[model samples]
Each structure stands twice: as C-alpha cells, then as structure tokens.
Target chain A: MLTGMTAKEVAKMVKNKEDLFILDVRNQSDYQDWKIEGEKVSSINVPYFDLLDGVEGVLKQLPTDNKLLVVCAKEGSSKFVAEQLVEAGLQDVSYLEGGMKSWSEHLEQVLVYADEQLKVYQYLRMGKGCLSYMVISGEEALVVDPSRFTDVYMEAAKQEGAKITHIVDSHLHADHISGGKTLADQTGAAYYMMKSEGAVFDFMPFEEHDRIRFAHVDLRVLAVKTPGHTPGSVSFFVNDKLLFSGDTIFVGGLGRPDLGGKVQEWAKDLYDTVYEKIAAMADDVIVLPGHYANLDQEVNAAGYVGAELGAIRAGNELMNQQDKQAFVDQVVANAQTETPPNFEEIIAINRGVDVASPERQQELEIGPNRCALHHTH
Target chain B: MTSNKFLDAKGLACPMPIVRTKKAMNEMEANQVLEIHVTDKGFKNDLTAWTKSTGNELVKAEEEGDVLKFWIKKGE
Candidate 1:
C-alpha cells in the first residue's frame, strides 16, 4: 500500500537535506510556476493525464535508492498515480496528503534566536516562500508578518504560555495575504501598519508609534514614506539586534519595488531605505525578511530563513550602492514582469477594502511566489 | 457555439477530468467538438495543456461561477 506524507514531513526532509526524489504530476506550467523545492530534492514531471491509463511510461524514470513521492495540484491525482506505482512493485512511493494545496499552507516553526528576555520563532511557510515570526516573552508574544493561518500563531502562543499582545505588518504585502487584521482580532492583540497603505481598517499606524514596547521587548519602526514596494512599506528594527526588513531587503538582493507600477520612483524609495535608513545598522544584526525566493540559498545553517546585515550587504549589488540614480536605474532595469498571483485582490483584502471567503482566499493565494525579480534577488 | 458531445465532469477531480476528456476525445470522429463542464478550477490550465500535448485542439475555455467549461475538437 502507498503511504501518504504530510507537508510537514516533506519540509523536514528538505530541512534535513535528505536525498529525496519527487515525481510531480501537476501540469507543466503549474510545475514550472511552483513545486516542492530544496537542495536535496530532485523531481520529474509526467502529468497525471499521461499516466491515466497506467504508470508504465514513467516506471523507467522512477528512482529506487531513496524515497520517492508523487505530488499534484491536490491529493487526488498524486494518490491515483502513487497507488499504481505501489501496485507495479515500487517499494517507496508516497503521495502528498493534501497535495500542493496543503503544502501551500504548511508552516514550519524554527526558533531563530533566544535570549533572557525573549525567544524569536521564524515561521517558514515553506511551500509559499513566505516567512512570519513570533517573539515570545513573559506570557506575551509579538507576531510579525503573519500569514492567513491565525490559529497557528494562537496555538504557538498558547503552547509557550504566552498571549499574543502585539501584531505588526512590515508593510502592505502583495505577494501573500497578511493575517495582521485577522490575527489581531482573533487574539485581541493590537495591530500596527502604515496608514498610507490605504487600509480601510482603523488601527495604530507605525508612524504614530516610533517604538512598540511590550513585556521586555522594544521594537523600533522604520516607515518609508515614498512609494516603495507600496506607498507605506515599513521595516521593524528590534532592539538593534534583528531587522524585519519587510520587502525592502531580501537575503539574496532586495524587494521588487516595481509592484506598485512605478518602477523608477519606487526603486528610488528602496534605494533611500537601503542607504539612508538602514545605513547605520550594525553588520551582525540578523536580517529577517517577509518573503524568500529560494529556501536553500537564503536559509542559514541556523535552519532559519534570514541572513546577517553584513552578509547581505556584502553579497548583493543593490545593498552596496552609494549613488541614488544608479541604484534606481539598476533596480528598474532588473524589475520582474510577473507579479504575485491575484495581488490586487490580496491587497484589497489586506487593507480591509474587500473580503474573501476562506476558500476564495486559498484559491487566490495558490501558485508560485513571484515577490522578487529573481530568486537571485 | 455548440458542441456535438457534452461531458459532465463537474464533480470530478484532477486526472479524472482529463482522463474522461481523453477517453471521450478518442471515441469521437475527427474534428468533432466536445464541450466539457468541470467544477475543478485547476482544470482550466490542465485542459489547455492536455489538449496541446495530445494533439487535440482546444476551441474555447472559460469560467462560469464555480464551474470551468472547455470546448475541444478531436484531432484529425
């Protein structure tokens, strides 16, 4: 009988860098757009339609030495293919339980840092390449850039014997839906974002609150006034130790300032934020971001998706620039044409301008992450 | 505007929709039009890829409410 592997298990395999083979049965374009990816992970695609009659044509392509998993848009097709593979005498065949849909929603919690005052947990939404975090102190938790899974944060807080007291969005997120409002309401925690993002909901703006101090933690807020990735992109600087660099600075390069359709103007804001705003920050400060394009490349040995400010500055050209026009020109030229899927709707949802059913939200959030010009970015 | 054959894969999932479409396409005479109704939203992308790969012609595809509709012409 073929076994079913949960998304969490697959994430663990990828995290452990285990040798794994994937037989992806989703359509070519879908697979091209997104799929389970990792350093140790290798894959082949034979759309389930080709295997509808039987798994014979792909039998020769299946790997034998290590674990093999079949994946599809949903569990149905993968299971259908895997059952046949098992029936045909393949020893190690498993299907992703809820398929890519579930993979898209899985959150792998990894503790990035711990000190006497607080412990920071980075929630890697591995399938989506979106990262959120929770800072836990004495019976209090502060969440940053939460995904739609509000319960996960709530549960994590409960397990830590902490109540979520503060929630902050680094900026107006276009790549994925922000759980800022929903999570705040669910936990009765105060939510903070830039008012310039044009959110319909009323909340404490980052502009008003220079620092959000609760329990033993104090987080400094840096709100970019110009049209950044959006008009009001903000980065949270925590105790000068960790920088929650919204979409402004990523591990590889920088955020796509072109999402607002003002490539040059927004790129200039990104340049200023990099030079004027983040210039004084020390090298050792760990830089955590909202989205990651490539996990293996961005994730450190610490098993968290982040990098040191010095490493990012040393590696990316965008981060090292001194001239404003040159930086803007380079960013504009390197702009990515593909935006995240259904971003307009997602922005509306984030701003509380529009609402979506849970099912509709899931549908809108599917496909690959296109937040960066390149994963190289 | 009209199809010679209609397939109701409305409640079906992946592989099933494409499976039935392939079977129906095989049964049809050359150039015959088959209109398919599937509730799976991902079917829109899958149907296009399936037709292109199998040498069938996709005449039209659109979404109506929660269901996805497609018209395909059997390859000669």
Candidate 2:
C-alpha cells in the first residue's frame, strides 16, 4: 500500500527543506496555471494520462534516490499512479491526500495567544494570504474575518470545545468571499459589520467603542473604528493585549486606501488612523492582521502573522510619516493600478447584494491574493 | 446523449468545469440540454451535488475512458 500525506504535512516537510521531488501528475495547463511552490523542492509535471500508455518509459525519468511526492487534481489519479510506481520497485512514495484541491484550500492553524481566560487561533489560508481568527473564551468563541472555508473554523471551534457565538467581517472584503455570513447561518451566531458600509443584508451593525462580552470568561472585545481600507473598517482589540487590525493595518504595511477609487480622501483617513488612533495604542499590544503578502517573510518565529505595534510602526515608514500631505502623496504614488480580480462581484457577494454558486465563488478567488502592498521601502 | 449545447471542459480543474457549465447553461433556454466533458476525477461528485442544489436536471452521466460526460437540462 502506498503511503498517504496531507497537504499540511507536505507543506511542513517543504518548509523544513526536505530533499523531495514532487511528481505532479496534473495536466500541463493546470500545472502551468498553478502548482505547489517552495524554496527548495523541485517539481516535474507528467500528465497521468501519458503514463496510462505505460509507466516503463516514465519510470526511468523519475529519481529513485529521493522520496517522490505524487500529486494530481484530486486524490484518485495520484493514488493510481503511486501504486504503479511502487509496483515498478521504487520506494518512499506518497500521494497527497485530497490532492491539489486540498493544497490550494488548506489552512494552517497557528496558536497566537492562550491563557486560562482566552485562547486565540489564527487560520492562515495557505495559498491565499487571507487570515481568519478564532478567539475562544470559556465555552463561547468569536470568529473574525472568516474565509469561504467555514468548515475549518467550525472544526477549530469544535476542537476547542467552544460554540461560535459571534462572527464579524472587518470590512467589505474585495479580494475574497467573506465566510462570516455562511458561518453565522450555520452556527446561528450573530454576524456583524458596520452599517455605514450600506450592505443590503441583515447584520448587527457595530459602532466605535462597542464592547462584546462573553459570560463565563473575563475577556472583553472592544471594536475600534479604524476607517482607511474602507469607510466602515473596524479593528477589534481583545482584552487590550491583542488587536485584530484587519485590513486597516498589515504587518508589512498599512492597508492601501485606493480600493474604493477615492484615493486622496481615503488616504487622509488612513493617515489619521495610523498617526492618531493606532499610534495612541500601547506599543506592546500585538497587532494581528487580516492579510499577509508573503507568508515566508511575514510569519514570525512563533509561526503566526503578527508583531508588536511598536515593531510594526518602526518597520513601516508609512506608519511614521507625520506630515499629512506627504503621507497622502506617498499613498497616491503607491496606489495599486491593478485591482483584485472580480472585486466588484466579490464586494456584491459580501454585501449580500448578489449570490454565487460554490463553483463560481472558487473561480473568482483562484489566484495569488493582491490585497497587500509589496512594502519595498 | 443528444443535447442542444456541448461544452468541452475536459482537462479543466475544479470550478472551471462547473463555471463553464453554468455560463453555458445561462445562454440556453429552459429544458435545453447541455452536455459537458470533464477529465477531473472529482467532477462527478461535484456535478451530482451541484445539480441537486441548483435545481438543474442531470439527464444522463456516462464515463468513457478517462473522460466523464454529463447531459444537464437547464432549469427555469
């Protein structure tokens, strides 16, 4: 029997610099469009159909010395191919469980904070840099900025022995579908967003200084209005120890205020939020953001996407620009020319103005996330 | 199977096959049959579940070699 490995396990091996060869059995177009990427691992694409004629010729091309990682669109083809490889006398072969579908949709849960009163888990959507959080306090939990993979958050909440009580989107997500509504519907949790966003859906509108309390635990989540990325952007501060900065601020840089097409006006809002509101917060508070541009660089030693507010502010020059006009000019100069793919439709879906089939949703979000700036400075 | 429209989604991955099928179905009138050819192994399960939820009728599904073919009738 051929061994089976999960996407997470394979990712860990790749991260550890394992000398393994990835035998991608997916078609040429699919392989070219998207495949696993790692610093050290090498991949060779050989369509599974090509091997059906016979594996004798393909067997010679594969390296017998290194461990071979077989991959396909889904688990079926990879398993069939791996079986053939084993029969051909090659050892140390394993197929990726659920195949490339799982790889693209995998989420890595990193424990960011924990104590007797509260525990925070960050679900990093691997391929996309979207970050969602699960904060468990006693028997209740709150999910922030959930992705379309609602089951991941549900499973995490189940493992923590907590029921999802509330779900909130930091703002209207343009790049990807927000799982908040679906999660709320599934768990009967209260879903919230800012009323100023003009969403045509029903949600508990959160305003500045609104405190959410869990009955049993001593944790209190305070919503702070941090408009910049969007007009209704808000960041949740948990127990004054950790701040869910959302898209208003990222670890690499502040959220680009150009998405709404009113760059100058929104940039001013971003500048004030950065220089006035965020600056007034304690330097020691950990800032957990909504999105990350590069996981390899943004993920810290603890393997979570965040840093102290002081460190974040010190690293990003945009955060320290005291002159309002200069900050706006810099932001305008760096405004993204290319918008997120299907952003209008995504926004419409997020606002409950439109609906999409699951397949349609996946097609709209199938690519590298363009929500964050490169932060070259 | 006979159909009013044919979509060659073979070699396409998940979502693309379904996405293309949905687009094809949109242009077709109600009761019009749309045929799709898919190579992804998981397309069978996806189409079965998708048709059930979307109110479309899966007229016939057949497998030939590595390809899976389905005839779907558009819903009103």
Candidate 3:
C-alpha cells in the first residue's frame, strides 16, 4: 500500500544502484535462502512471527535517511515497517514489492544468515476454564491482572525459571480480586498501577511513560491516559509491541464502559485510544486484550485473546469516525446500558481493600464485576 | 516574472504551507517568485522564520481582507 513505486521500478533500482542500502527484516533463515544480491544489502533479524512481542530496539537501529530499502519474507512484515518509519518522519523509504520470496525468484539472489533462530509459542497459558499469561524476558516477567488464585503465577514462574518481578493491573478489575498486591508481596516485586487510579482509589501510583526495570530487562509500562469506563482506567504497553488492553479494548470488540458515570467521556477516550494511539503502530503488533466476551454464549469458548495488529487496522470497521463527537454518538447508539449494583464492591476489590480471605479469594471471582455495561442477570 | 505563482495557504494548518511551498520550489526554477496566501494569525511570524531558514527573500508581506500574502523570491 505504499505510493510512488511499483515492483518493476524497485527491481530496476536494485539492479543498477552503485550505492544503496537494502535491509531485510525477516528471520535469519529466510535471509540465508534468498535476498537481492547487489550493492550493500544487509539483514537485521527482527523475529516477530505469529506474535508481535519485541521490536522497539530494532526500530531504533534503522537509519533515518539515504534511500532505505526494507524487505521481508512476505511483503506483509516489511510493508508494516516502512509505514512506521514514514510516520516517524523518515524519508526515501520503500519496501520490496514482493518481499524476499519474489526477490529470490526474480533476482536469483542467495539468502544468508549467520544464525537463524525464531521463537514461536502458540499458547501462553491455559488453566481451569481460564486463559492467562506471564509475559517474561530474561530474569523478569510481568503478571498481568491476575486472578486471586496466586499459584498460577508461581507455577508459570517455575515453568519459565524466571521470577515474577512485576505485577501490573490493566485497570481496576471487577471480574476478580486483583492479585497484583499479593504477588508483589510474595515476590518482592513492585505493584504498579496507573497514576489516574490515585484520584479514583487511594493507592500506590505510577505515571505515563514510566520505565520499570526488572532485572536486566527494562519493561517500559506506559500509562495510556484513557478514562471513562472509570475515570482512573488505564492500559499498559510493553516495548510498544504488546498492548495489555485491560477492559478498554478487547479482541474484535471494546471494553464495557458503564462502570463509571461519564459514559460519554469513557466512550470518547476509547475512540481516541483506538483510532489515535493503537491505530498508529505497525500492523504486525500482537494485541493481548484483557477480557474475552464469550462467557454468555452457550458454546463457551476462549476469549479473543491475541490478534495480529495489522488485521485490526485493515479490518476495524468503526475506526473511520473522524473525531470525539462522532465516536460518542456511535457508541451510545450501539452500547449495552445495564450496570451491576455491586459495582462499588467490585471497585473495592480492585483497590485491594475488599480483599478476600486466603480460602475465599477463589470464590469472589465468579465472573467479571457487574458494572454499568455488564450486569448480573 | 511578476511573482504570479500565487499559493493560497490561508486557513491551512501549521507547517503544511511551508512544506508545500518547499515541494513547489523544488520543482520550480531558482529566481521564480512565489506569492503565498495565509489566514492564520500566526502566519506573519511563521513566514518570517521559514524565509530565514530557507534563505528565501520575502519581498512583500501584508494583510488583505482576511488573508495575508507574502511575496517570496527563491534565492539562488
């Protein structure tokens, strides 16, 4: 979807260039098999296959100028990188028309990699009728909005041979008592919550763009200032690739906003977050959302857990609405208005004040807290 | 030339007119004068800074009705 050049035009450039920089963003194995063999062609192994986990450091390594030619195995990955570079105000950027596959066929080029390695994990976590995750790197891992059952985290740590060094609450969760504080206490990890939560609930605070270091790994958990589901609601971003969308954004859907009084304001924030912030990233990002709304259906299924960031951009039918005004109108016209009476109780649980006894923690989290958008029938 | 290449940059957002004018100048010959029109209250100061940066000559800059026009020469 880039403008100004076609496949044949780029092919011509690769053939005749005396000095040009060709960058391959594919894994090392693909690079070793076939690549455009002319001038100074280099490959950086940024393996974000199946899931988009780490790419921030890779983006920093790219040159801002001098006719950068980006290539990948298929055009999908490299095209995504080129668009991101353009957004960052880089000039003279273009991706190979058909990625390496086409280049290998047409240019008869050789792909070479010093060492080709890719890490792909299909299922992050699966428990008794629940799917959760402990995203880790090196000696540190983050336990996100965990259920009261604390053993899940410990077991995950035991499996990975890493310590749970950080506990993050996506939002003031109502589905279950947040295990953030408990996990922090046991592991001696810091409990991180959005700064906005200070006004809504008196608790330890963190602000936007705050970088929390865990062991040798630096996990910059961004507090995306999203309000409305509750005024203090926030989402977490790790390395700008994985968006731990609490209740605000779901896979193929959005968070229920009736928890707080400002239904109008909440809808507005959701609009800005979806269209402005989330939409601005590369298409290949992996979106790991907070909740999957499949509990009510008879079939009972896994929530829309993770999705390709590209698929959302090409597919979000509702993102075209121009501004905050149109977004509120659209949400009000099509949102569920029911809220739970026990929402305050749930908020207390999220605040860690209404914490359950060791034996009763498992019973409190029946479903998500009954809030304004979701209710107990 | 009478600086007849008029650019109506009135009401356009910041840096847009400058970016467009830069593009236009890149395609035009040096010494071709460009007449730029802008309505933003800040355009007077914006044009001053831009001309200084690009080393272009601002021949005449003033307000007419709701728009401000700046006649700039492409300095060789």
Q: What DockQ do you compute for every candidate structure?
A: 0.80, 0.05, 0.01
What tens-digit string does per-residue lDDT give for candidate 1 at A1-377?
A: 68999999999999999988999999999999888889999999989888888988899998877799999998999999999999999998899999999999999999999999989999999888899999998999999999999999999999999999999988888878899999888889999988778889988887688699988898998866753345536788987899998787889878776467777777777777888879889999999988888888889999998999999989876677558887777777888788889999998999999999999999999988888537424
Please give me the DockQ of candidate 3 compared with the native complex: 0.01
RMSD versus native structure for model 2: 9.0
Worst 10-residue stretch by lDDT in candidate 1 chain A? A224-233
Better lDDT candidate (2, 3): 2
Question: Could you arrange the candidates by lDDT from highest to lowest?
Answer: 1, 2, 3
lDDT of 3 by residue, A1-377 (tens): 24333445554554344345666665454454334544444445543231133345555666665577776644665676667666666677887775543442221111111111211111221111123446666656667676555675776676767778777776766544566777777887767787565324333566643676544444554344554234434666655556666665555556666455566776777777777677777776666655443322211122224666676545555665456787677676666655433456656867755655653443233222233223111
Root-mean-square deviation of every model: 1.8, 9.0, 24.3
Interface RMSD of each: 0.9, 9.9, 18.6
Q: For candidate 1, give the lDDT of residue B39.
A: 96
Q: What is the C-alpha lDDT of each candidate?
A: 0.87, 0.79, 0.55
CAPRI band for model 3: incorrect
Question: How far does residue A279 in candidate 3 sit from its true spot (Å)?
Answer: 2.0
Clashing pairs in 1: A253-A377
Error of 2 at A325 (Å): 2.0
Off by over 4 Å in 3: A1-131, A198-204, A215-218, A222-232, A295-304, A358-360, A367-377, B1-76
lDDT of 1 by residue, B1-76 (tens): 7899999999998878888888888889998999999999888888888888889899988878888888999887
